[model samples]
Target: MRFLLIEDHEDLGRSVQERLMLEGHAVDLAQTLAQAREFQQAAVYDLVLLDIMLPDGDGRVFLTSQREAGNTTPVIVMTARAAISDRVGTLDMGADDYITKPFDYAELEARCRAILRRRGGVADTRHRHADLTFDPLAGTIEVNGETRELRSRELRLLEVFLGAPGRILSKDHLCDRLFSFSEPVSDNAIEVYVGRLRKKLAGSRLRIDTMRGLGYRLSGT
Candidate 1:
């Protein structure tokens, strides 16, 4: 999944970015609201980790703007505020979840996964399509009863496919979801990932179909 992290604190921002990156997700870090807006305009994020206090303004302002503009990207507000009102107020502003500062990485990651699982409308990280079983939390995919680990990008690609099953996904949309803004990408990056995934899905009933000039779709062959 791709993420937009809006934070001003240097150490915390880097720490969180590194942690999320290590987990095989692409993340873009913005230290100010302006940069955050720029990143938002440039890329589509599956999730946004927002900080309450920013250099330009409070995080609530950004969240309010996103909701008013009909941007439904999930947001998780990170705040150091201890007051219950502050926590409740963020939720009222359309935050999907919130984590208090001074939090452990494990707890924060858990919250992120929980939100994503809910966003994908799946009860858990485990999903199966015919004989192909995917458990992202476990970092393993079972194809025709054979289990193996896939690369990070491959796993992420499966996550997107699993979320929408047979829906057509455009290359532009796939590119946005699969890479960070800073990552250098080739014109055929999505195709490369799709090709790799196709090889992995061999012997399974599912296949990725390329629609001419449209996009790609995961469907049973």
Candidate 2:
């Protein structure tokens, strides 16, 4: 999953980014509210880890703006303040969850996953169809109970398929979703990953159908 970490502290932001990366998540770090706003406008994210105190502006303002814009991206407010009123205010302002400052990195990761899982409407990380099983967190594919790990890019492609099963996804859209603003990924690269995934799931009922000019789909029928 993709995440946006909005923090002003350089050290804390870097640490959180590294930890989330180790957990198999793609994260973008924004050290200021301006940077965060820019990133939010350009890219889509599964979750946003926001620090309530910013050098430029209050994180609460950013949250309010996002909500006003009808952005439903789940946000977890992180703050040094532990006052009851602050917590209540953040929640009332539309935060999906909250974490206090000097927090544990593990707890932050867990909270992010919990929010995403709830929003995904699936309690488990596994998404299954027919005989094919996909674990987004582990980046593993199981066919007939035989499991194999996937490369990062291939796993990302599989994620898109699992999330929108039976629906066609254009290669262009897939490229935009799987890659970040910094990386340059091509159409052939996407095809390569898709080809690799097909071989990995060769024995399963899962099939990625190519619709010529349209793109690809995980065909159920």
Candidate 3:
């Protein structure tokens, strides 16, 4: 899933970003509310990881604005405030979940999965296409009873394809889900990942079709 992470501290933001990337989720990191707003305006996100204290504004107020504006994207507040009032305040303000700083990364990730699962109730994390079985969260795929480790980028690529099977997804859309907003990615980078995924699914009943000038689609043979 794609996420918009609003965090001011550079170190913490980078840490969270890297951790999420390792889990095969695309993330856009914002240091201020202004940047966050820009990202929100430009792209859609499956979730938002927000920090209460930002360089330009308070995330709680931002949270309030989102609710007032009817932006229903799930948000998880990440901050150092451990007060019970802080938790209740954010939750009342529309935060789906709250995590105090110095928390475990694994716990944070678990919270993310839990929140997403609730949002997409019964959203099957496992997908099947022909003889291939893909578990995106597990970062692995099974083909003909053989299991293969899918690197992060390949995992995200396959996940996006499976989300809209048989539908053509533009390169820009794919890029949106595969790379961060600031990552310097060339067109060939996506092609490289696509080629890699093609090889990974080589013997499966599913294949990727390239629609010249349009985009790519996953089709089952």
Candidate 4:
């Protein structure tokens, strides 16, 4: 998932951006309401972490504009205002969730997960490309009525590729998504996994295309 973080405090904003990137999600940070508004109009994000008190304007007004423009992207509002009225007002203005300032980093992560799960309720885990089907929940790959179970790493790599389809994802990005922050993985590990996945898909029409200086993409017939 891609996220937009709208915060005025540079230090806190950087911390949140680093943490979220380590968690494997693509993130973009905006320090002012004006920048955030421009980003919202140009790019689509899975979620937005909005600060109520921005340098240029109120986060509520920006959110209200988004709503009026029919942008239904989920927003989680963060504010220093702990008063009941402030909380209620933001909620009424269309914040999916609210977190007071000085929040736990872990709790914020959990809240983001909950909002995404609620927004994109149960995406299809079964992805299809031509005659091949990848079932993530079952950890199985099928081609021409033949199926085989995959190892855990293989499954994880396949899930990321299948989920994004045509997007080019660098090996570093892939590693971040496939493993947690503390896990130890070699620099060449992604290539090794890609090789294994290619072998698994050898008999099918689907293929992982490697772009020089860029990344790999799963292209299917």
The superposed Cα distance between candidate 1 and the true structure at residue 198, in angstroms, equals 2.2
**Cα displacement (Å) at residue 124, model 4:** 12
Write the residue-wise lDDT of candidate 3 on 109-199 in tens digits: 9999989778867478776778898886788899888899889899879878987998999999999988878678986888899999999
RMSD of 2: 2.5
Candidate lDDT scores, in order, read 0.89, 0.84, 0.90, 0.82
Highest TM-score: which candidate?
3
- Model 4, span 18-105: residue lDDT tens: 7876665556789998887677665567789999888799889999988888889899999889999988999898899999999999
Please write out the lDDT profile of model 2 over residues 19-64, one tens digit for every residue.
Answer: 8866656688898999988997787898899998799999999999
Lowest lDDT block of 10, candidate 1:
120-129
For candidate 1, give the lDDT of residue 163. 68
Window of ten residues with lowest summed lDDT in model 4:
175-184
- The per-prediction tally of clashing pairs is 0, 0, 0, 0
Q: Which stretches of candidate 3 lie over 4 Å from their true place?
A: none
Can you list the residue pairs that collide in candidate 2? Answer: none
lDDT of 1 by residue, 1-221 (tens): 99999999999999999899888799999999999999988887889999988989989998999999999999999999978999898999899998999899999899999998898788877787788888988888898779988888899998888767789999988887888876789999999999999999888998999999999998982
Query: The CA-based lDDT of model 4 is what?
Result: 0.82
The better candidate by TM-score, 2 or 3, is 3
